[model samples]
Target: MAIFVHYLSILLISAVIFLLLRAYRLRRLRLPPGNLGLPFVGETLQLISAYKTENPEPFIDERAKRHGSVFTTHVFGEPTVFSADPETNRFILQNEGKLFECSYPGSISNLLGKHSLLLMKGNLHKRMHSLTMSFANSSIIKDQLLVDIDRLIRLNLDSWTDRILLMEAAKKVKRNNKSLVGLGPSRLSSESKMALLITFELAVKQLMSFDPGEWSESLRKQYVLVIEGFFTVPLPLFSATYRRAIKARREVAEALSKIVKERREEYEKGERKNDMLGALLGGEWEEDQLSNEQIVDFMVALLVAGYETTSTIMTLAVKFLTQTPLALAQLKVSCWKMSGTDFKGKNHRTVVKLLDDVIDTSLPW
Candidate 1:
């Protein structure tokens, strides 16, 4: 019986190898050129390298030059297409709603819950968008979110006089902003502040794992595990039995729940907040609208979406300053100019220009 089992294993291994080779040969014959790595794993290693190579854009552009605008490559286990041609990109980016629907990871609904409008499709998005218009207005933004944003910025700027570590500074900057704007109030009790900070850090860590570079297969698996807990169905259920998605999924949910509860109370008492949570709470939905758990999930999704992008841009700005001395000097100069600028139309455009120039330079190709 044992001898028979050993032969069975050998046959199974041979079949798998044969299938992989067949796929490789077929792709080579027809598909676009690419650095196809190992059979199943492919260039996943390169996509997930620990020590990222500098000038990632050129690395991608170089590949595009060799392999046209639209090419196929296997990263990890999935076949992904890189599109850069003007017409194709315009179609994908502008018409993601019409031509194509986003396939956000199933894990997203797992963590953020099913009720988030971000997860909502089609008419649902249009419906919620109608409500969003009221809160998205300039007056509402200035009153609720921007004031907190400036307050957080001033706090961060005051925290440093001469020197600070850029990455660490960027972190504190995110925390300060999250607490002030995302958390509904600048001043929260110790419990709420710690929860917000810890949860925010965990969520960001999971999301930021994917930097553009070569990724190792092992690292990819573990990294996915770290971030996978919040999946629509815990990833483990798909792989083996059940496994929880660590605490990130739960912590974010809890923090969101607290925020929603607080906002509801405040709104009940006649205090309006600026963040998306306020928009969501104030919006009209169907008879059920959303449950508290689901609302927490939506808030978690929003927090990750809104906050991470802002923090990343700030991080990119700091990284840019490291290379360019003139840029660093300009950041200081810009800060000073912002302080002197009045809150009026003419001054606003200049303030915007200063920000725009810095941002445009800092952007990655």
Candidate 2:
């Protein structure tokens, strides 16, 4: 008992000394104003709590009122500086490699891999960003992607009949004794699943010219695990979700690596497809000659980004459109006009222009 007590005292003293040293170092530098909250855990619980509520802005709003747009706080086992100012964010992005480095929590960084576009820096990031942008340029969208998007939308929409309630469909809720019950073992809402399927299918098609198949479907299932664990506590020892995510991430990377190698071999054999993978493999630029590992990481990051944000936005858009009769009416009218015109010739431009106008006027950004 005496020996155990002695070791505990020593550990406590070491921790105090470490914290004191850290505090002294921090005192030397000028940091933004804000409380760090409790040591280690910090204000993460408060942040999470606020986000769980209907309105999360109060957490930031109260902090901004107390301090400013930029304030210091600790979250996810690290000290962080929060910037709510638009100009400050713009400046940080503009000078990313030079003045700032993108730092995410270990959970995100580990799952995304070191070579992910989001985690990359300097010239590598610039090269990859340029490549991605070139692939997504307006000409490519209009000439290649838009037709696929239209077809996918129409295909999905065919199931939406008057018998199906929009809210119930969006929530994946079923009526049982006048009460709503969630569907599926995963518990993912119907609208979210639909959005994810659309986005994932489109991403795979564009990236590797992969059609909707059992392989792509299997990959998408793994991605659901990865996405679900993104915001969870990063303790794999204690968290089954994190553990599942880590396993899923590894499987995804391995699968993508295999595909990348096969695609490279195909390109060498003069078998080509006009997809992002082909561009990376066959491009003349030295920078475009990425390794299989890099390509896998890039694809994983892009898949996560494309599906998560796009699906959330799509689900919310559907929800809002259902709520707003005026916007829904305008959208329906625009769709009716599009249905009458041939989507191949001059009418293509007209349909695109009409869509642009509808999106501009109907959706509240």
Q: Which candidate is the best by lDDT?
A: 2
> What is the alpha-carbon lDDT for the whole of candidate 2?
0.75
What is each predicted model's overall lDDT from 0 to 1?
Answer: 0.53, 0.75
TM-score of 1: 0.59
lDDT tens digits, residues 1-365, model 2?
Answer: 99999999999999899778767766676788887776665687687666555467888889998999999887756677899999999999999778987778877889999899998877888888998888787465556676777777767766666555666774442221110111222545656667778989889988988877899999999987887666555678766877999999999998999999988888888998888888778665545477888889988888887776776566666655665778778878878767755475677787778656545543563
Error (Å) of candidate 2 at residue 61 is 3.0
Q: What is the lDDT of candidate 1?
A: 0.53
lDDT of 1 by residue, 133-216 (tens): 664565645343333345445544554556555545544543433222212224433323333333343333222222222332
Model 1: ten consecutive residues of lowest lDDT? 204-213
Instruction: Give candidate 1's error at residue 54 in angstroms.
Output: 1.5
